[model samples]
Target: MRSGIVAIVGRPNVGKSSLLNALVGQKVSITAPKPQTTRHRIQGVLHGDNAQIVFVDTPGMHRAAKKALNKAMNDAASNSLHYVDLALFVIEAGRWTDEDEAVLERLKSVKSPVALVINKVDKFSDKNDLLPLMEKLAPLREWAFVMPLSALKGANVNVLAKQLMERMPEGPPLYPEGQVVGHDLSFTISEMVREKLMRSLAQELPYALTVETEAVEREGGLLKASAIIWVERDGQKKIVIGEDGAMLKRVGTAARRELEEMTGGKVFLKLWVRVKEGWTDDPKALSRFGYEGG
Candidate 1:
């Protein structure tokens, strides 16, 4: 059977996580509108009749400051390019920026074949314009394949999956046929909570906060899970909690509903917001939050 690792690399919000979910037909990675929503290397597995493809969704490649967490995220993305058998270089259709160029530069040294994936093509008004965009991008690197598709709309995503599956090397499947992801249940559940919290908050809170599942216990048919939401400051914590803790209640409700659907069981979710100053810049704290350096 054809099976191998493929890394999805791109600038933030270019739909890399969405593409992984689309390819695997499941949510292996949590996504938000904000940049750097993905901080770890998430693996999404796609199983076919005769082949299996393991797609690694990396953190978005972006210019980092001297912050330890930022560097770790950048390292995680760059490291993904090295270990994979194939790399999908995702970019927004009809758009190219220095960050995209920066990602391409990192791919230059990798031995794997790079496939240029032009995502979000459903936004394009004129389909004919893609030829010029492809022409403009091809000169920069000799791409193994240039595919334009919309990860959100599922347009041409199946074609992209077929092409990647054909490129897989002949080997045993890295993961079992029924397995669709590499993350643990608790990890994915906490991520779901974080996703809901991130979507509920303002622009600044999402970056300052991170969620961790403290405990998951089975009480008969329901799963009782407790999660802690860490923020950088007490003020941020207050904001997250809102007046009479309404914000937290809403976030928890939304998260619990999604978690129930994902796990196929009733969930009793409890969330607590705490302040931990400078956690993002501290390497030890970042590691505690699963942003360990590559």
Candidate 2:
């Protein structure tokens, strides 16, 4: 059997988390249209007949990590490269920004074989249009493998998976059969709730808040979960609660529905919005909210 760890590294909004979910055939990580929606290093495992691939989905690595939270995310992304069997350096089909270049520079120091994964190829009408971008990136490094695929639409995803499986070192399965995510149910619940908030709230407000699962219990075929939505100020808290609690209700409903679908059980979710006063910049608060390397 073959088993290995593949770290998926890229800039924000490049669909790293989406690709992980598609590969695992399950939603092990949360995603949003906004940048920095992923703030942790989440592992999604893919089990084949003779191989297991553990894909580490990391936060986008970018510059100007002024806040403690942002620095921690950058650190998480960079740290994931250590001791990895392979690294998938994912990028958009046609766009190469400064942050992408930054990530490339960082990858130069890693000993693992780095594969260039050109994601979101469906955005282009003609496949030939990708030639220029591919040619530009080809000379950057001796890439282990280069693939162009759409993570969202699953176009060419199978080919990418097959290529990755072949590169894994021969060994036993790293995780048990039928298991996908490495995180616990609480982490999943918190991420799902945060994803809803990220998609539902204003861009700035979503960055100012985080979700923490306080309690979880199962009773009579129902999974009951209590969580807190911590914000920075009273105004932000009021906005999250919304007029007559409409916003909070929407977030909770969406999260609960997704949770039930993911867990294959009914979910009783309770959410409360509270102020934590600049939690994003506070190291203690960042640790409390589960931001590693904070």
Candidate 3:
């Protein structure tokens, strides 16, 4: 059997997380329209008949500011390229940008074979346009394979998966058959809460919010979970809590329902919003939010 790790590297909103979900056949990472929605290196394991591919979904590589959090995120994305069997350099179909070039430059340092993945092919009108796009990108670097696929529509994804498996070195499976992700229950629960908040809140609020699963306990036939939502300011906290606590209630309800389905049992979730001024820029605060390696 073949087994190895494949790092999906790309610019923001290029559908790296979507590709991971499609390959794994489940949602192991949270995806949103906003750039930098993913803050950590999420590993999703795909178990095949004779091989297992562990996909590392990373934050979007972008031009970084001086903020510690931003630096840490860029570091996370770049670091994922090292120590991997293969790298899938994903780019949006029909277009190329400076940020995409930056991602390509970063991949140059990695010794692993890079596969040029042109995602979102379903957005193109005429299929013939892909040939010119591929020709334009081909000179940037030598690739193991150039594939055009739609992560959202799952077009050609299976073919890409088979090619990737064939390239991986022969070894035993790294993870059990039933396991899908590398993170624990608490991290998944916290991410679920953050996803709900990201979907419900305004554009500005999503970046300012972070969730922590404070406590999780088993109570008879149900699972009890307590979480805290950290905001950067008092006004942001109020916005998250909403007038008369309407917004927080909505987020909690949505999280609980998904948690119940994920855990296969009832979930009792408690959510609270707290203010932690300038958490994003502060190194200590960013670490508390799980942003490390700056």
Candidate 4:
């Protein structure tokens, strides 16, 4: 069987997370339109008949300010390039920016062959409209294959998966069949809750928030879970809770419905917000929030 790690690296908001979700044919990673929406290396395992593709979806690489968490995120995205079997360098087909080109340059040091996955093709009227932009990126195109696909619409997604597999090294299966991802049901449930909160909250608010699964109990044909919504400030906590706790209720209810559907068990979602000043800057806090390194 052909199996290996395929790293998806790109700048923020270029549909990197969306592409991973599409490849797995499931909502493995949470997605939002905002930049830096993904802050961790989420692994989505794709098990086919003869192959197992372990897709490592990294956070968007960008220039960061003082915070160690910001630096860690950028470093994590770049470090993901090392030792991968293949690199899927995702980009926005509608527009090409210098920042995108800058990120592509870093991929040069990657040991694996890079494949360009041009996402959001549905935005264009036709392929012809993208030819000019494609021509501009043609120099790097020689080093990789260009795949025009829309992650949201699943257009040409199968084709992209087929091509990506062709580049993977032949080996034993990395993961068992019928397993869609490496993460467990509890971790995924928390991620979904975080995703909904991330999509709904303001940019600054989402950054400060982190979701943790406090408890999971299965009884009487149902699963009940308690989750905590963490924020860095009391005011941010108030906003997340909202007037009469409307916002928290919305996040909890949406998350519970998805849990019940995916897990086939009823859920009791509990949400509480606590203010932890400068959690992102604290090394201990970052590690607790799923970060690997210092």
Best by TM-score: 2
Backbone clashes under 3 angstroms, per model: 0, 0, 0, 0
RMSD of each: 1.1, 0.7, 1.3, 1.5
Q: TM-score of each candidate?
A: 0.97, 0.99, 0.96, 0.95
Worst window of 10 by summed lDDT in candidate 2 = 285-294
Alpha-carbon error at 82 in model 1, in Å? 2.1
lDDT of 2 by residue, 1-294 (tens): 999999999999999999999999988999999999899999999998888999999999989798999999999999999989999999999999999999999999999999999999999999999999999999999999899999899998989899989989999898999989899999998999999999988769998988899999999899999999999999999999999999999999999999998878899999998899989999999998889866
Clashing pairs in 4: none
Weakest 10 consecutive residues of candidate 4 by summed lDDT = 135-144
Best by lDDT: 2
Judged by lDDT against the true structure, how good is candidate 2? 0.94
Residues 100-166, candidate 4: write the lDDT tens digits.
Answer: 8778878777777888888999999878998887777777644558888999899998987887777
True-structure Cα RMSD, model 4: 1.5
Badly placed stretches (over 4 Å) of model 2 are none
Instruction: Give one digit per residue, the lDDT tens place, for model 3 in 1-294.
Output: 999999999998899999999999988998888888888899999888889999999989989656777788888988898899999999999889999988888888889999999999999989998888899888888899999999999999999999998888999998998899889888888999898888888777888878888999999989998999999999999889999999999999998998888888999999988988888888888887788573
Whole-structure CA lDDT of model 4:
0.83
Candidates sorted on lDDT, descending:
2, 3, 1, 4
lDDT, candidate 1, at 259: 84
